[model samples]
Structures are given as structure tokens and as C-alpha cells.
Target: MPDNERRTDQRLERAILELLDRRAASATICPSDAARAAYEGDDDGWRALMEPARRAARRLAAAGEVEITQAGRPIESAEARGPIRIRRTR
Candidate 1:
């Protein structure tokens, strides 16, 4: 991957984790939260980071750092179809 893309990916991952760190251990966060945090601009450009944020969440899930859930139930990242939330693995 290009350096910029790699950096973005890393930033998204860190954003997801950092955001979680600020919440209660049992609390969860939406991917959009990380996307918005990762985005530096003061515009709707964060929308473009949505997919990247989801991908970052999936990567974090694979690394056993987080869980991806839909309807409050843990699901495989690949099986996450619609809206989902990220939470620290319990």
C-alpha cells in the first residue's frame, strides 16, 4: 500500500482504539466515530473514511483487540452486514 494509505489505515486503527479508551470498558463505539476522529478536515469528508474505519475495526477484531457487533451480539467481521459497533473484547 502507498504510504499515505498505510498511514490512514494506522490512524483509523489508533482512532478506534483511542476512542474506546475514553469510554467505559463495556461501552461501544460506532465506526463512524472513528472515521470522524481520524478525519482532520472540518467537513463532511469524514464520510469517505467510513469504509476505512470499518476496515480498521475488522483488522482490530482480527487482532483480538476489539469485537464487532450488530444488535449487541458479537459477529464475525465478515458477517457484519449493516450498522455495527466496536467494543473492547471482554
Candidate 2:
């Protein structure tokens, strides 16, 4: 990946982990929360980061740093589709 894109990915990953750290251990977060936290200028531009945010979540999941779930059940990141939530691994 390009340097800038890589940096953005790293930022989103950090945002995901940090956001989870601030919440209750059982709490979950939408990918948009990380996108919003990583984004600057407070505009809808954060919307563009949605996919990247999801990818970051997947990466974190693969690293065993987080879990990705849908409908309150943990699922493999590669199999995740539609709405999903991120939470610290139990």
C-alpha cells in the first residue's frame, strides 16, 4: 500500500483499540466510531473511511487484539458482512 494509505490504516487500527479501551469490557463499537475518531475536520469525509475502518478491525481481529461480531455472535472477519461490531477479545 501507499505510505499515506498505510498511515491511515494504522490510525484507524489505533482508533479502534483506543475506543474499545474507553468502553466497558463488554461494550462494542461500530466501525464508524473509529473512522470518526481518526478523521479530522469534522465532515462527512469520515464516511469514506468506513471500509478502511472495517479492514482495520479485521486486521486487529487477525492479530488477536479484537473480535468482530454480527448479531451479537463472534464471526470470522473474512466472513463478516453487513453491520458488525468490534470489541476487545474476551
- Best prediction by TM-score: 1
Pairs with steric clashes in candidate 2: none
C-alpha TM-scores of all predictions = 0.99, 0.97
Each prediction's whole-model lDDT (CA) = 0.97, 0.96
**Superposition TM-score, candidate 2 onto the true structure:** 0.97
Off by over 4 Å in 2: none
**Model 1 Cα lDDT, one tens digit per residue, 1-90:** 999999999999999999999999999999999999999999999999999999999999999999999999999999989999999999
Give per-candidate clash totals: 0, 0
Model 2 agreement with the true structure over 13-82: per-residue lDDT tens digits: 9999999999999999999999999997677999999999999999999999999999999999989979
Error of 1 at 48 (Å): 0.2
Best by lDDT: 1
lDDT of 2: 0.96
